[model samples]
Target: MRIIILNNFFSGTAYYCFKFREYRLFWIAAFFSNIGMWSLVYGRLWLMRTLTESEIFLGLVLTANLTPILFFSLFGGILSDKHNRLTILRITRLFFAIFTLITGILIHLDLIEPIYVIALSIITGTLLAIDIPARSAMIARIIPKEHLPNGIILYSIIFGGSAIIGPLIFAPIVSVLSIEYLFYLIGFCYFFTVLILLKMNLRLHISKLEKKISYSRSLIEGFGYIKTQKNILYIIILGVIVGLFSSSFEILLPVFTDEVFLGDSRVYSTILLLLGSGGLVGTVILSISGNHFNKLSVLIFSSICLGLLFVIFSRITNLNIALMIVPFIGLVNVWKGTINTTVIQTLVEENFRGRTMSLQQWSWGSAALGGLFTGFFAESFSSPFTLLISGILIIFFSISIGILLLSLFSKIK
Candidate 1:
């Protein structure tokens, strides 16, 4: 039974993309690194509480970690276009280890301060801002174009799966050992990522014209490309809408279980488990057969379904009924995300791929900001009502974008 399971795992439906050595190593390297990164997020937030019990400082810690992406991702995008992406990944990831190690050392020495932690967060966040575009740009270079969608779905699986998997694994480590040791473990994970990246032999082409362009011009060109490419622009806008409404609702989950359903912590955990299970099912199905569908049509229909699910989910007064609805929420949401990313990669030019992707890097920050606003509105209008508005807005905008896309393609024809 174990042997059969291992065999199937090694030769799964998405194994076609995994056949490439570059992507395989890249995936393996990124998996540990991303897991560490996600797991350490809790450590950082926890460490902040140790430094200062003030909720304001804790909030600042998170803001410092996320806000840099808003401004620096553009610069990272330019760096991706102008330089060797593999090299950028190497440098940024190396620093990821370095800073992480530095934080651990400070904590161990009893020299850590809230301000110091916040400063390190800014540095780490800035490195991430630079890394994201280069890392994304590297995807096309490593994988075969024919299997790109499957490759992308697999990549998304690692990332999204890590968010749930990482904390669960590392949260226990932080509890069992010291939080400082958790940092050391996370530091080693990143160092291991650097080691794996060094071993991967990847050859990427760099254009001479890309080398000679000014930063100002390269930035301008990225915007110009997206502006002229209506599809890319519309797709990015849709991504923003999804991020703001659907992606950020995890913040409201506790409120849902506590206030709306009058349940306890176990119920909150149950909601999370259901959501994660749904996500797993959705990704598995998509990884196996998502490539057969028309990308744009799948994207539009998924977005609409997701919006409706959000509406239905918000209105659910019964826990069992909400549990059933939650998995479908996870399904169409993943469908929308997977198809959105695949569509962008398929349509974007190599030089613009990094920049085009960088502009979409608002996912984390936008979700954070959207959650705050949603919370504020929920306080006034109730969580259910605010979420209902979110759903309506998403549906309205998804259809609007779909219509714009149809019109644009019609004119192109």
Candidate 2:
């Protein structure tokens, strides 16, 4: 009776992965942990904007967080494949808790600076290079193959829900206590994640699929799969484009709330809340539909939509219209991600899944480079102009490279 109720509550395949005890608990823990992490991130952005009042510093913080992943995630993926994923996850989360608490202490002492914040982001990024792949690979270990899509979709909802809930939760706390408390709260969340990770029992090992190979060989093998699989390569490339250009929208958000909307942190929080709400809705709809979509075609169409939305949002002068448009932007973004991630998860073999996902993350991390460009252009010109040009680039890439890749993909199949 309870099983039936749970299934109905989650809706459709969303509950398929939840039938597993490990996934159910992991889902809950990941949700709250992400909320804490994202709230900390939002708080950091607010703090950076307070300190520097420069778009560059805002983008720099993101760059520091992502750049390490771009360079180091492959090694992390290899480690995930070779080591115990749960152990890696637990260790990283523990360090994250410690580091965040220390940062909070610094801030509480009024000793925190922009450089310190950037340094902490760099450390977190390095940890994520390992943590993300191990964490993602663990999902495959715990869930059955037939229900991977359900796991992926439901897992994504954690993030979508967190994105909304995080800032909303942060606003009141930071407003009442201070930014340091937000960091302190984030530290507690990571500690909780570490605790939950320790309780997970994953004796299953996919690493046995590959014999003891040299580190270089393993790295080459992962890259080899991507090189040979032209379609997957196409998807990764397209993701790079999306990450690079669409990212400017976020990089400019603090600027938008300040200069464009003429408001403060509350306004910034409201925009994040709307964006996250749209993402949550989009993920839920996908989950209910059983991820039944033409993966390739929908991916392309969503890319075009994202590019168009970025252009529209940047050009519009009306605050109300812009606010209305932000949600749509969030919707398209999550849909593209859900389809892309599910397709990759389905196609890649278990052994290569960690590496492939790490690469996918690396492409997404190009947002750092995007942020750099965004900050540069916004500082040199105007935020609107920066975003307008970025939108045009996304459209150009989607139409040009996207079409060429699709043509090749169809012919090969």
Candidate 3:
């Protein structure tokens, strides 16, 4: 076991360095952005708990952040097409940094309240709704088209790297130092990210703004494009399924920690770390593989593999087994990062890249909207049963989508 683990760890590390050297500036900027993001999320959740001491409030706060994406992401996409993505990112990052700093000061002054937090979250969400599309689309500008798959993988590594580092540092620092100070730390990360971004000479890929269409038609056009492109829709549907059910591992894992492992906060943290480590490994694999395979087939197979792993994870009662599978969960996420985004970007024209990405984000927004609520039910009822059901649903849904796409492909051929 030790030998296997060491081998995987070394391999993951080697891949990260090789791929990271490809986009030095964006890679550094991504690391900073993810650190800030992780800090903000940890601070936000902790702040809510400090204010209200209610799980319901925690759920509500998450919902508030997600709600705007469900509604306004389309507009975000439209804006991405019409403007310079770098400029959009710079403006939003500046505001986001300021907001983080102000929130820290408010909390330190004991002026914090649920309303303030919720309102701040809403404002942050509005910025994120715009920022995400620009950020995702900016990948094409940063790396060579042939290396886009590697870019996606490296992006995932940064994401998972943040996941590994963020919470590990986050929980302890806040508990020992002050939660208010954590916000300040996040603000610093963002400001540093802005500095890093300013130095990069990214050739802005701007799509021409066509004749003004009604807002409804603009949105309809994004959907219409996907509808005609069966492969794209297939990827989107699989994304939604994975987002909804297969990816609920974090929510469901606490039960495994408590009931199976008979563990506390310490054990929970360990599991989370293992999961993050797994993700890092997965990202490295995808980064090295680059774009050697059919991305669509990779997506379908990885989804099924992820679902099966979840099913196995749901049934396991032993800590040893849980630890072993943690990396596989991360592996699935790496698969998700590479295939999902690459497929979408390849399918869409530069003009609609933003909106199309935004439409893709809707799957996430909708999933979060649903998952948080369902989680409450799972807690109230039985967690193990809830996890089992969710895992099974993911397996069936993803496979069915894959089959449908396969049949469609056959007909076209």
Instruction: TM-score each candidate.
Output: 0.81, 0.95, 0.84
Off by more than 4 A, model 1: 1-13, 40-64, 98-121, 174-185, 205-209, 254-273, 316-323, 363-365, 378-386, 410-413
Best by lDDT: 2
Alpha carbon lDDT of each predicted model:
0.76, 0.83, 0.73
Model 3 residue runs over 4 Å out of place are 1-23, 46-55, 111-116, 211-217, 252-266, 315-321, 410-413
Candidate 2 residue pairs in clash (backbone atoms < 3 Å): none
For candidate 3, write residues 1-413 as lDDT tens digits: 99888767545432333343326777788798888886675467657756764444555566667678878888888778767777788788888899999999999899999888878888888888898888888777766665565566667778778778876876566667878888898898899988888876645455565747666677788788778887777777778667776535654554466667887545666676777787777776767665556767777788888778877877888898888888887778667756788778876776678888987876566655644754575556655666677777777887899889778767877
The TM-score between candidate 3 and the true structure equals 0.84
lDDT of 2 by residue, 1-413 (tens): 99779768665666667779888877877886788677766777888987888988888888888888899899998988888777787788899899999989998899999999999989988998988888777777778888888888889998789989876876687677888888888899988887787777857643654557887999999999999988788888888878888878887888988998887777788888889988899888878878566667877888888889988888876677888998888888998887778777888888888888889886668987987998888999999999999888888888887788779877987
Candidate 1 weakest lDDT stretch, 10 residues: 201-210
> Residue 121 error for model 1, in Å?
4.7
Selected candidate, larger TM-score, 1 vs 2 = 2
Which sections of candidate 2 miss by over 4 Å?
Answer: 1-12, 209-211
Winner by TM-score between candidate 3 and candidate 1: 3
